[model samples]
Target: MQTIETVVNVTSERQITVQLPPDIPTGEYDIVIVINESVKSEKLAGEKKIKTLKFSAYPVGLVADNFTFRREDLYDR
Candidate 1:
């Protein structure tokens, strides 16, 4: 497992884009994107806003829109 860091400017799009590689390894990993300098929330600790996202992405498998699904409404069998 490895950790990658990304940085974006504070103008224009101001967004970070990511894509998975075509060839994926045979294991499980996680991608953690953290914006250290964002003021998009109410801060109680000295005006330092912290946004945390810990996403779980599979290497090679079917992906879903939601983590949990209601099988009664989607499936009959």
Candidate 2:
């Protein structure tokens, strides 16, 4: 089984056309289509706001205050 993802433009006449890769054999196969309304609305609006995640740095005291990392520590000597 193979999966291919691609975007298709809908015509004003309410039609959509999809072009499959040449490697896909010429035969009838079961397929599924999913339409994302949220994505369509964002594209029509012409503007989108991106949300970013913010983080605060604090010491949890998981290690000693004077602890340091060394390459040798990664393996048992």
Candidate 3:
């Protein structure tokens, strides 16, 4: 697995997004994503979990306001 750090510009229509690998296997997994912390800043403004995809190691389309992340096709669509 790869650990990636990226910057997302937040504005009137943008929020931070953190995505997983494209292919996920079946099992149990945990995910954590945070945003808006510069090295000089002292507070942790954002720390969140992608909490819509059923929490299975394999799921699909974790989403929130202006943000989304996915790694698998959890449904038959």
Name the top lDDT candidate. Answer: 2
Per-candidate clashes, comma-separated: 0, 0, 0
Would you give me the overall lDDT of model 2?
0.80
**Worst 10 contiguous positions by lDDT, candidate 1:** 37-46
| Candidate 3: tens digits of C-alpha lDDT, residues 1-77 | 54666655566766655454567666786756665456325333344333455555765654656553444444455
Local distance difference test, per candidate? 0.60, 0.80, 0.54
Top candidate by TM-score:
2
Across 11-76, the per-residue lDDT of candidate 1 in tens digits comes to 677765565555766677766767775433434445765667989976874456564467875788
Q: Could you tell me how far off, in angstroms, the CA of residue 61 lies in candidate 2 after the best superposition?
A: 37
Candidate 3's displacement at residue 11, Å, is 2.6
Model 1, residue 1: displacement in angstroms?
A: 1.6
Off by over 4 Å in 3: 17-30, 39-77
- In candidate 2, what are the lDDT values of residues 1-63, reduced to their tens digit? 887777778899989999888999997999988887877888867776656698898867748
lDDT of candidate 3 vs native? 0.54
Model 1 regions more than 4 Å off: 9-15, 19-29, 38-77
